[model samples]
Target: MSVADIKKHLYKAIEEIDDEAFLQAVYTIISSKMGPGATYELSADQLQILEDRREKYLKGEGKSYTWDEVKDRIRKKDGL
Candidate 1:
């Protein structure tokens, strides 16, 4: 879809949402992208770490979990 169409749909969807926390999270994300300081620069070490992880994952040597799995692990750890 076009950017304009996507934005129009987002506006309508956001208007229908009644959850304050969900709206706040959306607002936070939007503001971070829209505001100054939105452009992030990774330090040399941080970039190297990310590159290393990507290489490992591409080689099938890095373990990964789905969002549901991570949530389940967190809940189990917290006894929630």
Candidate 2:
């Protein structure tokens, strides 16, 4: 079957799940299969840009938002 077919079946299976313990186990299995977070090596230019942004933030030249505020704004913007 195609990836789309597999995804549709997976979605249906997820929706039909009723046992909380089984569902949690399924989540753990999927998380393990997906492995760890991604890693990237930044180039010198990218690193410099990030450093500049950090310096600006330290100097209070840019605004910072709390995680909750950011998530709320994102959810509202996306109509989630």
Candidate 3:
């Protein structure tokens, strides 16, 4: 279906929703989507690890592989 059709169906469904708690939850979800993109809450240690790996990659110290090489290795291991 088209976007307009989906919106019409959503509006009708929303109107029929009468539970206050459910409505509040749905409102919170829709509002979150309408605002800036969703965010991730990462721990300090996890963030540090990611930053360290990125730095190594930028410095050309990280191991890399081509797509074909990766597929060949997977195929070999799987005996495909």
Clashes of each: 0, 0, 0
Candidate 3: worst 10 consecutive residues by lDDT? 33-42
Error of 3 at 12 (Å): 19
Residue pairs of candidate 3 with colliding backbone atoms: none
Quote the positional error of residue 18 for candidate 1 in Å: 43
Q: Report how far residue 37 has shifted in candidate 3, in Å.
A: 15
Query: For candidate 2, lDDT tens digit of each residue in 1-80?
Result: 99999999999999998999999998788877775753346899999999999999999997899999999999999998
Error of 3 at 49 (Å): 1.5
TM-score for predicted model 2 compared with the true structure:
0.50
1 against 2, candidate with superior TM-score: 1
* Candidate 1 weakest lDDT stretch, 10 residues: 32-41
The CA lDDT of each predicted structure is: 0.94, 0.90, 0.90
Per-residue lDDT for 1-80 in model 1, tens only? 99999999999999999999999999889978787867567999999999999999999999999999999999999999
